[model samples]
Target: MMRVGVISDTHLRSYDRDLAKKLAEHFKDVQMILHAGDITELSVLDMLEAPQVIAVLGNMDGFAAAQSLPAKRELKLEGFQIGLIHGYGPPNGLEERVRREFDDVDAIVFGHSHKPTNYLLNGLLYFNPGSAAGGRGHPKTVGMLTLGDSISGEIIEI
Candidate 1:
């Protein structure tokens, strides 16, 4: 299995030293990191030790690079198809959105609600790591996912 550090919504007003240190400790052995978006600054990605980082642009990500990031993406890990998106529709319909946007993926990961969640539907898993940066109205949160032959995940607060 491959361990993935899942982070999202870090809208930094200034450097976050505590967050950096916490990430280093929590994601120490993660093979990669995935940012589901709303990253207002570029430096957030720079602090990660993982060489492979995949990110999407959230509504609040105002940097130049963020504009170019696709609203959605797909990735294959350990023979599992994974999808990433920043959902904006009603939280109740989130499962349907994942099903509609990433029909072929075995799993989907997203952020924007600033609330961690996990669900299984149509033989696929959908995950939201919430606001890893605890930006403004959100509570600080982050999670780690393990990918392999079978799909399962957990949400963590840090």
Candidate 2:
């Protein structure tokens, strides 16, 4: 199986040692890492130690971070098509907005609402790992996806 670690809305302007430690512990067995955005600084990405790292630029990202990353990304992993986006607007319509963005994806991973979600809708999986920095009154958390013959995921509190 391929294990993937998912995170978003870090919103840290600098490297966070505590976060780094938490990542190491939580994602120790993950083969890849996906950052959904609001990363704010490139240093945050640099601190991650994963075989592969995929990220998108969030609305709150600074010039450097924005310039270095795409606003959206489509990746094929373990026979599944996954769309990664930072998302936009209010939480209510966020899923509809993302659904319209990608035409042929098996799953969509996003963040912006600072809320965790893992649901299957019309045969598509909509996943949001919430805020790793605990924004919007939610507790800090991350996500994990195990892919093989079937795909399954879980939200892990940090």
Q: Which candidate leads in TM-score? A: 2
Could you give me the TM-score of model 1 versus the true structure? 0.89
Best by lDDT: 2
Prediction RMSDs, each to the true structure: 2.0, 0.7
| Candidate 2 global TM-score | 0.98
Q: Which residue ranges in model 1 land beyond 4 Å of their true spot?
A: 135-138
lDDT of 2 by residue, 1-158 (tens): 99999999999999889899999999999999999999999889976779999999999999998788999999999999999999999989999999999999989999999999999988899999999989688999999988898777789999
Alpha carbon lDDT at 103, candidate 1:
65
For model 2 the local lDDT of residue 17 reads 92
Q: Clashing residue pairs, candidate 2?
A: none
Q: How accurate locally is residue 121 in candidate 1, as Cα lDDT from 0 to 100?
A: 69
lDDT of 1 by residue, 36-155 (tens): 887777667776668698888777777574656778899988898999988776667766665688768888899877878787866878788878766546578887888876867777
